[model samples]
Target chain A: MARIVTFFIMLVFWVLISGMFDAFHLGVGVICCLLVAIFSHDLLFYGHPDLLWVRDIFKVLAYFPWLFYQIVLSSLEITYIVLHPRMLEIIDPRLVRFRTRLRNTMARVTLAQSITLTPGTITVNMSGNEFTVYALTQKAAEGLPGEMETRIARALERE
Target chain B: MRELQEEAKLRMPWQDVILQTSVRVLIPFIQLFGLYVVVHGHYSPGGGFQGGVILGAAIILMALVFGLPASKHYISENVNKTLSITGPLVYCGIGALCILFGGYFLDYSALNRILPLGPIAWRSFGIFLVEVGVGIGVMSIMLRIYRVLSSAGTIDQGL
Candidate 1:
């Protein structure tokens, strides 16, 4: 099975890279590998139905660097808001729901996680096509379902 | 022969089964890395807890690749239950031992005299064991929660 093969390849790659082939430590490595194999069996077996194409995998990977940049930018903005004396006057917190175009579970989950990582936006709840998001500012909430939803839709090729 | 072939057909796909085997093969190296992280946690950026989770994740990864049944075959539910309890028991036992030596609960300094070794020499080992226990408890509980919730189809269906 692909699952078992992936597990073995990952282990072999790890051993080759880590060079943990010492005599006494070999037993420990074996035990650890066994545990990994035990836990990860489902992923290997299922192979993520949502990730049917290589392009989908690449798309998800490509989103990470951009997501990190967004996180940094938002963190700085949050820091500035926190340092300001009249922070409460500029900040508005409320829950707003919007529909998303992404149909795949993985893409939606990634979007939620990405939004949560960014300051000023927190995903409160998600049900079907609707997402309840908490935003610190209305400006932050304005494009709620547009930019992020578009990006995730693109990543998932779901339109 | 036809009936037997049909039963085999009902099993998971060949690709998935291969992936599961591969994941199992790879577990040894990931585990060693986890151990390295655990042992050097105090001096480096990681610790026992991180390593333990990584180790657990490796297994969980295999489970994801293989079917739940195969994964359960590799790591029985009983073993998980035992590990879930054993970690806390070990931690508590260590604390009790410290108390017996007339030191505060979890005081490692008191353990030196009991072990026929120097205090500083044994303290690191004591801390290492404690961290292992904590890691085991946390990892088992997290995995168990995931398994239970997923089996109940609550989280999976919601996703």
Candidate 2:
């Protein structure tokens, strides 16, 4: 079942990238996709992705817009900080550590990546559920693993 | 013996749960992109070599984040060896095949005699096949280099 889904996913991706409708091209794409599916079908869903994954995926899709908004907001804030005459004072860099309730590995990593993606903060180290983040200012530092953690939890948490 | 095992566990390769999970989630897409580059080489800026390196880097990224044992477990010695060997064979085999068809070495259009795709199509396709071969070869070799260097010619845990 997972293999079939993987095959279709690879096929769709192949068609999208190949951009060819010819029978021969389609045939080759099928062959290549089949090989990939056979080799890594188990990997596509990561350890028996159950029916709940559909819900999780849709949840993640919905989370993207909010994440994008955060990215834009952070970028604008970073720009303001850089352009300010008192940039050094504004850039009060500090490392902050916090524990997270998110238990799922995928969820935790998503939070970490999202945090890093947003400007002004970098997820420097993560041990177990604890994230060691570096932020350029106290304002940025205050938001460490805050709403992004909750949104990702909503998106990826299994239970 | 028990003490040695305990010591090994104490110094077990640093496993950041975030890095491991992130690498796992990222790997399939990277491999897919690598395949895309290999197949698209004819019309694009990249060909087999670049595609192969990208493919190889996915595994290298795996090794970097997940450690040697996990990497080795995912891609065993036997599988790696076979992939490395098959690449060159695919490359030279096509060249030899062109020769058998009474064409000069690496002359792709000569492959038209085997399956009558038009010469123009064969010429384009032959390059794709060679690129695939190169991609496979380069990827495997790149992985081998990393594995050997990291382990210092030993597959066991080492400094």
Candidate 3:
């Protein structure tokens, strides 16, 4: 079933990309997609029975806009810091480490990426539940793994 | 023996739960975009090589985040070897097909004899087919090289 889903997805993607409607083009696309599907279907679909795939998809859709807004907010903060006359005095660059409660790998990665994507904080390193982040300001580093971690955990929670 | 295992675990880089979670979510979209690039090469700035690299990068990202053994589970060495050859074969095969149809090598218009599509349409379709082949070949080769180099020619341990 997963294999079939992978195949159809690849086919639809191929057709969408290749606007040619001729029989020859469609036939070639089908052949190419079939070959790819047969070889790499497992790569695309791991098929964990416990996964709430549909619900998670919707959750992610809701999460991205929030992440984007956070990104904009951080960027503005960073921009202000950079443009300030007393930039050196205002900035207190430091590394902060903290552990997170999120267990899922996907959720963990999202948090790290979001941290890095946000301007004021960069995830310097991550190990297990512990993350070492570099923050441009003391304020940015104050609440380490606070809201971002909670939001990512909520976004990825199965329930 | 247990002491050595513990030491190894300590030496191994720590896994961040957030990174793992986000990469899991992002991989599918990255691969889908890669396929889009390959199929839409005719109309877009991207082509087989660029799309193939992007696809390869997705796998590399997986390996970096999840570890080598986990990624090998998805694309084994033998399958990788076969695909590396298959891509170029597909490309050459189309050219050979053109020859079989009594046209010069890589003459896509010759495909009209087999499909009865107009010469112009055949040419366009043929280019798409070749692009698919190139994309496949490049993607596989990139994965193979990364596997080899990162593992230091031994698939057992990867950096």
Candidate 4:
């Protein structure tokens, strides 16, 4: 079942990109896609068998808009800090440590990437549940692993 | 068993919930974009090699973040070895097919007899096929090199 789905997805992707529509092109696409699907289906869908796949897909889709908004907000904040006259004084760079409730590897990674993607904070290192983050300002570092962690946890929660 | 235990003990310093979650979310998109690059080479700046490298990097990123053992579960050493050969073989096979069809090496227009797509269309379609082959080959080779290098020529231990 997964193999068939993968083949169709690959075929659609191939047709969409190729745009030739000639019988020959379509034939090649089908053949190539089938070959790939047969060999690589497991790689495509490896791990995370517990979650409802459809629901998780939608959950991730819903999370993107919120993440983009957060990115914009942080970019603006970083720009303001960079342009400030007392930039050195305001930029109290510090490292913060925190642990999250999220247990799934995927969820944990998403939260870490979210932190790094947001302008003010960078995830310096991570081990098990704990994260060491570098923040550009004292204020940015203040609420370590707060809203973003919770939001990602919610987005990827198994239940 | 003792060596395996020692390897396990040489752990990365930190792991956070956020990093794990984000990588899971991002890897699929990264691979999809890589495929897009490979397929849209005619219309885009990217081509087979670039797209293949991107795909390989996605897997490498997974290995780096999640550890080598976890990645092997997705793409085992045996499968990787086979794929490394299969990609180039696909590319060369197409070329050889063109030759058997009575055209010069890599001459895609010769494929018209087999598919009736006109000489010009066949040529374009031929390029697409070659690109796909190249993409696969490059992706596997890159992954193979990274795997060997990180593990110090062994499939286990090291990174």
Query: Considering every candidate listed, which one attains the maximal DockQ?
Result: 2
**DockQ score of the complex predicted as candidate 3:** 0.29
Residue pairs with colliding backbones in model 2 are: none
DockQ winner between candidates 2 and 3:
2
Residue B24 lDDT in model 4?
A: 55
> What lDDT tens digits, residue by residue, belong to model 1 across residues A85-104?
99989898877877777776
* Chain A TM per prediction: 0.77, 0.94, 0.85, 0.86
TM-score (chain B) of candidate 2: 0.89
Summarize candidate 3's per-residue lDDT along A1-159 as a digit string, tens digits: 666666687788777767788775577677667766675665565464233666776888988998899889888988898899988999998878888888876677778888898888898766677777889898899867788788888888554
What local lDDT score does residue B131 receive in model 2, on the 0 to 100 scale? 88
- Distance from true position, residue B19, model 1, in Å? 25
Off by over 4 Å in 2: B1-14, B108-121, B157-159
Q: What is the per-residue lDDT of model 1 for residues B1-159, given as tens digits with 9 covering 90 to 100?
A: 354346446753342322434464455556557666764565566776787788677666655775456556766788989999998998999999999998888888899878766888668768877877877887677667767766785323210
Q: lDDT tens string, model 2, B54-98?
A: 999988887888777777887888899999999999999999999
Off by over 4 Å in 1: A12-31, A43-55, B1-159
lDDT of 4 by residue, B1-159 (tens): 344335336754323344445575466556766776887688778989999999899888888877878778878888888888888998999999999999999999998989897999888878888888899889989988888898889878546
Task: Put down candidate 3 lDDT per residue, B16-99, tens digits, no spaces.
Answer: 455566676567657766876887788878989999999999988888888888779878888889999999999999999999
How many pairs of residues collide in model 3?
Answer: 17
* TM (chain A), candidate 3: 0.85
